[model samples]
Target: MIVDANVRFEALSALLGTKITSLSGGNPWKAAPALSVDDFFIQLILNKKTSYAEEFFIDEKEFFDPGYDFDFTNLSDSAACMRGNEPYVRPKGWYRMALKVRGKYLDGDAWLGTNGWRSYSVPGEWPVSYHGTGLEGARGIIRTHYKAGDGQQFGRGIYSTPKLNEAEKYCKTFKSKFTGKTYKVIMQNRIKPEKRQIIGNYWLIPVLAGTSAEEEKRIAESSIRPYGVLIKEM
Candidate 1:
């Protein structure tokens, strides 16, 4: 399917939080917390009132097996504790909360199927991490197995990088991998960087699926106009 760059940028921009400046000379970016405030509160309550250790129980067969040293009495006590407090533990509401958030940020016309959701530009299923030595290392990985079909949509995982040059390096490497192919990079506004081991601005880079290598190359090289926020496309 032909994904519209402008439409995708609009959707992604709306979901981004406020941009944060980095002290490390990286691009400004935004971040979505791993857990929302509601989720945090629920976890805090669970930690305070519940004994997670009590939820585990050893099988009688394992306890009796001579090959393994078993603490049968302790296991029994833990199981008993879990059963005794079963009524107090509340059901987790994180999944429901996530669904609500997805609905709020996703486009209205996006298809929400039983297995997953999909829009013209975004995939309901998140992409796997592109594990490599550096941003440019993606070229070697893509050259090995990346495939492009006429109708199949492709998504690149979002990541934070302090340097715009690093992101450009990735773009250059990715484009070279698909030399003579057509693809479109839907660039989004840089978001506040998450204060993690790696600190930088977060950006989503999506390439549209193409029919042929030349078409894919064209798509990859084509410039995307900025939407609500200005973004540099390579």
Candidate 2:
């Protein structure tokens, strides 16, 4: 269950709009948008993206919550409109489109899990603002509740969100999950200040499935490989 550190990450600025970028000045970000080009590296240069976008993952803090399918009641808007401190409004058309798909929203899950096409969006929709997908997309929020209450609070879902950082902060944080511990931060090449443009892009990177390096192999085998999947495997 140990995560292969060798695992890598990549991203696109937008989906379904011919996502493309141009490499302009000495500064990687001076680049402009091109046409239908898929540049995994653009995600690293833009500070507007999530930390995992830049190729490095900062370790985050583990969180806790008794309820599994909870919602952040403070916001005056629906669950999909809020991310961190920013309130994004999905274009009316996109919102309607998502509804057409009838995607099911997980309790505190960052995005719409539509027919297994998993995605986490700030505003949530067709234009699809995502750091990446799966674990890479859920990293930031994972830092929010690390070491939170040891037990559940009320329902079946987790309730939380994460703050911001310059890689250094999250680089050392760790998040505990029902399955295992997930840590994230900026990747190597994207750590330089100038290349941070894409790192700033905010998308919820999740803890892709894996085991903690610190645990004994046998312990991992006995305790669980993936917590939800019952039975033993060796």
Candidate 3:
């Protein structure tokens, strides 16, 4: 079913804390001016009013009721990474409730500086990465910035993975006192191609061989930016 345009737009605007005006000055989904998904994503990525972003969405189609198990047998490798291990919750087995993220990338910013920049690239062009973080940590990254030095296994940058299953391994679960339901949080990010370093199935900001602590922090923060928060109920 087609979702209401106003409902979608308002939900996004409120989450991102900014007003998102229609490109055609009217609801494109309604008629006259049809805004394609590409155009809609481009507008948010290039809009100069915000440094973070102005888009987010809740997938109504995904089940949110408790104890619902999702089947992942048909998912592609890029969508979910399956693994066999103890405490096994099949990769991407939970329904994706809400994904809060928008396309926003500013040139000459800490995340993507002016060098070797792609003028034609929008946020959608960037590679998708997942960062498993605590609920509180996710909040801090969304409101402010991602704090590095968490799992500096391969260096000193914020750790993330191209595989959702890899990220799931790092997620910390918490039981809500109010609902008695346990949940895990994961932050979805877009990594700068040149700024990230690959090391055996994981992606991290390249903290040069012998860089000082301060420099590593700078690189880590600039190399990756969180765009969405993925929540799963257990």
Candidate 4:
């Protein structure tokens, strides 16, 4: 599960519009009305018609919750401090899109199975972490699972951070021709407490020092799950 240290993360800004065009038989975004950066990313991820695709669909089921709002409750003290101290990061930021996907070995999960996707913040489950990535990376994760080789800093596992500022450091910038502005995406994930190892600021899903390749992959697929997508305009 190890990746070469020389590998570089390519910026996907150049391909965003092209990909959308192919999927939609043209650059539908251009013909559509003006939208904020938040709505743009949400539309891309949902992969639905822009005219009436405001609701977020989890596992093909429509969830009634709509609109974005700042969540001030249920946040830990450290979360508050990081958001408060950071200049660009807002403590009262809203999650415009909710992405709750069930991964392998999660059918029988105690927390998720009992309370369902709505119980994302319930205690005694996986803790929250943020993984900053480009639009391509976000697409891959939402469509499938995380590729172990995508991250190699801490030995080939999904990389994330508890602090938003730290995660923001890894966020790749994309200049949108449609909006004439730049945007960044951060995946709000839940890391299994028992399967993850914290080394300084990075949180890695698998302990891959002496494990087989298959084992490392399994731990990664089951341990980390993305529940939300957070985007910021830079």
Q: Among these predicted structures, which one has the highest lDDT? A: 4
- Clashing pairs for predicted structure model 4, backbone only: none
Per-residue lDDT value at 107 in model 4: 51
Error of 4 at 87 (Å): 20
Candidate 1 per-residue C-alpha lDDT over 52-84 given as tens digits, one digit per residue, 9 for 90 to 100: 321112122211112211112122222211111
lDDT (Cα, 0-100) at 192 in candidate 3: 66
**Overall lDDT per candidate, in order of appearance:** 0.23, 0.22, 0.42, 0.43
* Candidate order by decreasing lDDT: 4, 3, 1, 2
Q: Residues 109-215, candidate 2, lDDT per residue (tens digit)?
A: 22222322122433232222212112233233221122324442221111122222222233322232323444332221101111111122332222222433233
**Number of colliding residue pairs in each model:** 17, 57, 0, 0
Model 3 residue 210 distance off true place after TM-score fit, in angstroms: 8.5
lDDT for model 3, on a 0 to 1 scale?
0.42
Better of 1 and 4 by lDDT: 4
How do the residues 15-77 of candidate 3 rate in per-residue lDDT, one tens digit apiece?
A: 233444344343333332233332332222222121333332222222111222233334444
Which consecutive 10 residues in model 3 have the weakest lDDT in total? 79-88
Using all chains and alpha carbons, the TM-scores for the candidates as numbered come to 0.18, 0.17, 0.43, 0.50
Error of 3 at 9 (Å): 22
Which residue pairs show backbone clashes in model 3? none
- On lDDT, the stronger of 2 and 4 is 4
Any runs in candidate 3 off by more than 4 Å, and if so which?
Answer: 1-91, 94-104, 108-124, 134-153, 208-221
Candidate 4 structure quality by residue, lDDT tens digits, 107-208: 544433223223224444566677665445542222223434555334444556676776776565665555555656566656666776666666665444
lDDT at 139, model 1? 30
